[model samples]
Target: MTPHILVIDDDAAQRRSLKTAIEALGHAVHVADSDQAGLEVFRRHRNEIEAVLVDLSAPERAGNGFLRALGDLHASVPVIVQTSEGATHHAVEAMRAGAFDFLVKPCSIERIAAAIDSALKFTRSGSQGKPVRRARTGTVGFGDIVAASAAMGRAVELGRRAAQSVIPVMLEGEAGVGKEMMARAIHATSERSARPFVTVNCAVIPHSLIEGVLFGQDSPAGSGEVPGKFSEAEGGTLFIEEVSELPAHVQTRLLSVVQGGEIEPAAGKRPRKVNVRLILATNKDLIEEVKASRFREDLYYRLNVFPITIAALRRRKEDIPHLARAFVERFSSEQRLAKPLVIDASALALLTGYDWPGNTRQLENAVFRAVVLADGPVLGERDFPQVMAHMASVRASGDTAGARSAVEVGHAAAAAVQETIVHAPNPAPTVESPAPTRAAASGDLSANVIISTDEAGNVRKLAEIEEELIRFALKFYRGQMSQVARKLGIGRSTLYRKLKDYGIDPDDPQKHAA
Candidate 1:
């Protein structure tokens, strides 16, 4: 099937080039040279255009504003962004504002076509030749967790085993680790697979009203009463999240219900019996809470009867590549884009090194950002701005460490030179010539370069080499002096001295032009 695409760029040359490239792939293409013209084209062919490709650097209109316009237009039609080389943060923001995918500039035609295909596949999931799976019964199955890590695998194994028993299970982990998903999986695998799985966020419920919410409350005279989570979950599973946030009184009440298989309703005339199984989750350390006397020891023991601790993302860095691929596939399928939205190795490396303080949730956001901003088939390091920035900082820090090591080695070599001079025999104050002016080995030289200019012609070559190094240093430092000094292995003052000696101005307009 021919996929219709709209290409938006302020550069007429780029717009024409992209339109021709996309059309060459047997797809229909529409072109616009400005954001306003892009919107007009989108509105005119709203139904015909399956996707929109927007330039991130388009002038006279902010990318965010264009994204908002697209959102307001075909809300469901995919909008792919074309971003500059290093503007990942802008890409992420565009994703948050609803871009479908983004591509970096100077991308190949094949890559652009692939991105369009992936986006189309994402939007057309289950509509054409998609596979169907038989739904599993009782507790929720391990299907929703989407993990490929050994740590997560072990946790799922434990959960499956725990499902065989009717005991109350407690899941401990940081937020966004998919604890609730695991809880449902256990329920689906257990005897109560057909029963409803009710979930309640303990932290969201007020302490004063938690008892009524969990155990039901009777109506006033002549009024109807409502059932609480326990009654709603009868013959099923009650999954309580943020369990550690439950007040002491609520904890005691919950304990009685778990132990007795019954609960007394608020304003109750009689105690009601329930046959629901219980699953509790918390991101807190219950042991510490118990020690601090903030949580009930008895309640902890009751829920801790079957404990499963979910692993954090950092501990499972190896799973990132898989997760990233999965996310790409998911978003691609949802947006009706094409398949196998490949991520280049550099992009994958950036994702793997991220600290991921938000775990799976953060990873999802990053993937979504990449998909929305990517203009090509493959996602690269520039697709996720925050992640790329963090990775850059980490690399810069590593570079500094390498420089320090080099300086230490240089200092030790100088000390050895002093020792050699002192130990020389028949020291008649012989004057030694300076070291030969040979080209330094490629890798070993620090930022320092030896320039030998005789009375003539060497001046031009020396000037050229100095200009190149300065440009390299400036690019490496992103035009920051402190960073340039660190990369050059010179103190800030010494860098200034060299800059003057080389007849270069630290703040020259030509130097910072790029």
Candidate 2:
């Protein structure tokens, strides 16, 4: 069952964006615009809701009040706080008030998903919940496939339904999307679990030999019989990979086997009954192949009976964090690490931002490489130099196709709403100075900007100048909190508070009437 999460945030845009991102993580979300609405939703669906996400920057500090209300109601669901204020006091206060986890704003979706996963795991462990049963390693089952994204979840659900029958399942997806893995899972969960699961890649075999490799052949030397994959998987499954590459003649033979449940052991030899289940996988679009006169229409119809299309890795980036973590755990054990190495948030963010062209296979190999070279207990951003380099190259080329610089949710809005608190060095007492040169060379243009003067040529209010500087700093640093805070000579909490006080919005800088 998918976990249900309750999100309480007064900002409608934030609520919508959060819901979009969270639902992609394979969870059901219930949202509220206020603490009272949140409480009503939680109370009505307390048994189903597994976690709660609350914004700590709500008006009147409603997040803090909600925390106290949850305590009063004796709610046990883990509450994760996501706030714009990056102050130590804010985090400490939330933790002391019983937040299960704290996340700073502009947080990566991967980090939020990881935190929710941990909270759920803790809850399950506390409740003594047992994991879903699955086949041992090497025998892939639906349970072993990480379907943390809705697209993959739908595909997995289809595969599960197909596994209950002996129907021919056609898996269509890009190479490395794990079509073969899905085939294995289907076979493992089917009634043919104990039977042999033979595999043959039509694309890899020689065109002349693919037929013989699939349907068995009589020994030309008359020494004995040459058993093909179908014979080997009698009363079991035969997973034909790259099935679109099968020869025209082999397609006819495969069609016969599919329609009549029989296979020819050899040319001119009597047809033999084989109880093997057929699961064909192909990365090609069979419909296009058929239109191109490359594949048999009848064979396409036969194999397309139960089609399941696995989504590419990029289309389902929400699953990257979980998949990467699973690979890290597996490789850590394989490499025999002294301690299980964990992936840091920065590293996960880096990975989740990239569009993996090779899909899961690529991510798996990347994690394996990182695990082998890592010397520390945690894998950091430095561990993935190749990915970093690729990301840099992509950014340099202005190629949005390769990777997104950041997650889309509230990224621009967050950037627009920052404040600057950097205190400048005290000016020399009434110095007679020359005209100021461009401050761009020193990378502090905000310092040299001409202050606004009134109609009488008098200097403007200090508060007004401060607000302009804050806006300049935010634009200068590109919304990087650390850089903005350091340049402003103030802490992040102070910057956030100032931004609130000045009513600074990325869309609308000044809120007060002129």
Candidate 3:
């Protein structure tokens, strides 16, 4: 049987290029543009399909579902996720979700062939080939959480243990690290798995209605008659997200519920006995809040009985590969696509290197955008423009390792020029102004100082006056370009850019006449 590979990418050119390249490597290639289409093709030719090359760059999607589907159909069949530069967020997710390998876009033919060759050698140790093995219950724990790092492993271990008891479990971490998901997983594994599970994000609810929303409202104003989250989750789990955002009164109300194991309805309704278990999640520190008197100390103790702190993305970048892959599959399944998008190597490196101030949720949003707008199945550095731009800026500054030195140099130069102008000799007092002078200040040597103003009192553009200052400094410093740049309080490169912008000739220093 001729080894056939299925290439799933939205870009026609990329599909054609890969097909031609893979075929040249002595294997056949089948191409699909979307996840739905790819899955159909993979199922139809399940046995004939040797490997799958998927693009997981769509910020809005991932190819993992298709890959997972294909895996179930043919567990031995390997799925190679191809991503563009700056998109490694999905690499681990792909691997954890059962992908054979990960590759970056525009990778060499030899590399692709090598990965495919390895993938073909794969044999599943699991039960079946690719029947979407349900994650015990849902996408939360077990294989769902996708932990590889010790930090995450410990956090997940705690979460699993917290499921055994009906005690209130409080999850602490930066938002978007899947606190709610953990709550659900705990609910699924507990005795309350058959009961209802309700989630209430306290931060989003109106301050006035929070109590009523959480503790059954009895014909409350404007809200009509509504059961509180407590009643809704009776005999089940109630996950309160952003729990600290609840107002002081709500906190008191919640305290009663936790302490007395009952809830009081709005407008003086009878306090009702409730059997709802609490699963609270907060990005804020409950201990700190308790100390600050913002959160009740007693309530904090009750909820903190089973605390599981989900690690932030930055602290656990090792898990980025799995998290990224999981999100790719997660976001991709939500969209209607013919093929799974791939994140390029550069993208993966970018993601891995990023600080992710926004955590996993931020990564998910970026991936969603990449998936939705990516032209090809490839998500490269260009897919996440804003994030890549920040990363690039940080890289530029870090690369020099002494950008501060350059800035300091510019400031020193500008200070010298200021000294010459303010204390040198006043340059005969020009007719346009008073020798283009002003009081010296810190932080910005050139800013707020008068150089040349039009007769109409309109302030001349800073660049023009800056050019004049540069020319004046050059002549004053005797054609020393370095001196002029220093007196200007800006880096040499910045001075050069400014010089070019203002049409200043650094070679000819005597050219004044500002």
Candidate 4:
């Protein structure tokens, strides 16, 4: 069904432009000249209308009253406010009064479209009333979450369930999988939405200062300079990222918060009561850490009350187009680029082909880099050379058996493009070799070949095989990363990552070996 949108703007020309633009997006537009008229129209067609776009400056009492009234009336229908330069403060007040988001005057078509898209999503969310989509923020929300894969859908559902409770939520994922963003969304939808939301990076904060940074002291100045995150996030949320990086003592203190629901400052003699909804994120498996004694078992159990595992970017290839577009729009707006960058099909295909080792964060950064470097309005395959290289390698490797593992794919791509004409024994016991041995063959492609295999030649892990292949390629390429990477069927970046992972130094490994 076509989404219905109500636009309340006094300017006839502006209303026509908005209606045209929104209708072009396949949404039915209902235009009203004033807030009262808009409300009457909305009341008559409440169920049909999905979203409201209002000019905050048009209404009486500076728009907050109008927004409050709309919220009181519609309750669930999202209301987007538009403000001019001097009305930015009023816009903030409107948002606090339950406006979904505000658009500044002279806002670009892209920005307005993004805002409406978010609003429509929010409106749909309210209609669905799914518990998982509780995080309703002006920015990222469960509704705005770019998840096309089943894995991510499940994660979002779990996150929603976790948001309904005040218990600690533990998000486990790779480093770049947007754990912090998800935490924010969870907090935004939770009952503590009105309270302060604080974040603490356990990995970055100084070891000695962490305790005082978390648990506020009783006395002034000497005891604690500022209110700790617990006190700062009172009646709100405290999101602790890289929780596994916390020192043992700090972990113990956090465990106390989980168990006792109060904090005992190092300098304070008494335990102080603080109300905070705890949300912890980690890139490691806490259960494995607990088993290895690296993480406290009790603390892990407490935080793991509602565990959410985020799927890495590579596993959800279908979401690449959506995520890339979002990033392009977001970064384009941020950079103040005059024209929005458009990713061509070839560029998108390349983006979807490679395994993003750093996950969503890496893709976002890559898109940002592309947007920054891109000269043309249309971002072509050349706009992202790294993705192209990896895509080239991955496709080149598909000629043989399906080698989906990054390492194996890299090796297969290398084998496909390598100039050495090296040969290996028949991959299967009964299968004939593609090329004849030097003894039986003329000096053709078959004659100049050496069998590339593991030293043991038994069934070894693909990683071990890839390491040997990479070593051989580096030797053959003589430290030329481009040649080596191309031969290996991987991006130079991926090749570099593999080198670091395998500790392969093309130039000076012997010196560091000792």
In candidate 3, stretches whose alpha carbon ends up further than 4 angstroms from where it belongs are 1-141, 220-225, 266-269, 399-514
Candidate achieving higher TM-score, 2 or 3: 2
What lDDT would each prediction earn against the true structure? 0.66, 0.71, 0.65, 0.67
Q: Model 2: per-residue lDDT, tens digit, 350-446?
A: 7766777798999999999999999887898799999989978987998753434233322222332221111113211110111112234266644
Worst 10 residues of 2 by lDDT: 427-436
Q: For residue 227, what is the lDDT in candidate 2?
A: 87
lDDT of 4 by residue, 333-436 (tens): 66767665656545654565566889999889899999899887777778888876775666687732222322221222222212212221211111011221
Error of 3 at 310 (Å): 0.8
- Please tell me which model should have the higher TM-score, number 1 or number 4: 4
Candidate with top lDDT is 2
Q: Select the stronger candidate by lDDT from 1 and 4.
A: 4
Q: List clashing residue pairs in candidate 4.
A: 132-160, 134-189, 135-189, 414-487, 414-488
What ordering of candidates by lDDT runs from best to worst? 2, 4, 1, 3
Instruction: State candidate 2's TM-score.
Output: 0.61
lDDT of 1 by residue, 460-504 (tens): 576666656766665433344444666678765566666666666
In the range 112-176, model 3's lDDT, one tens digit per residue, is 66567755654332112222223434435454665544345556667778888888898988888
lDDT of 1 at 143: 66
- Please report the candidate that would top TM-score against the real structure: 2
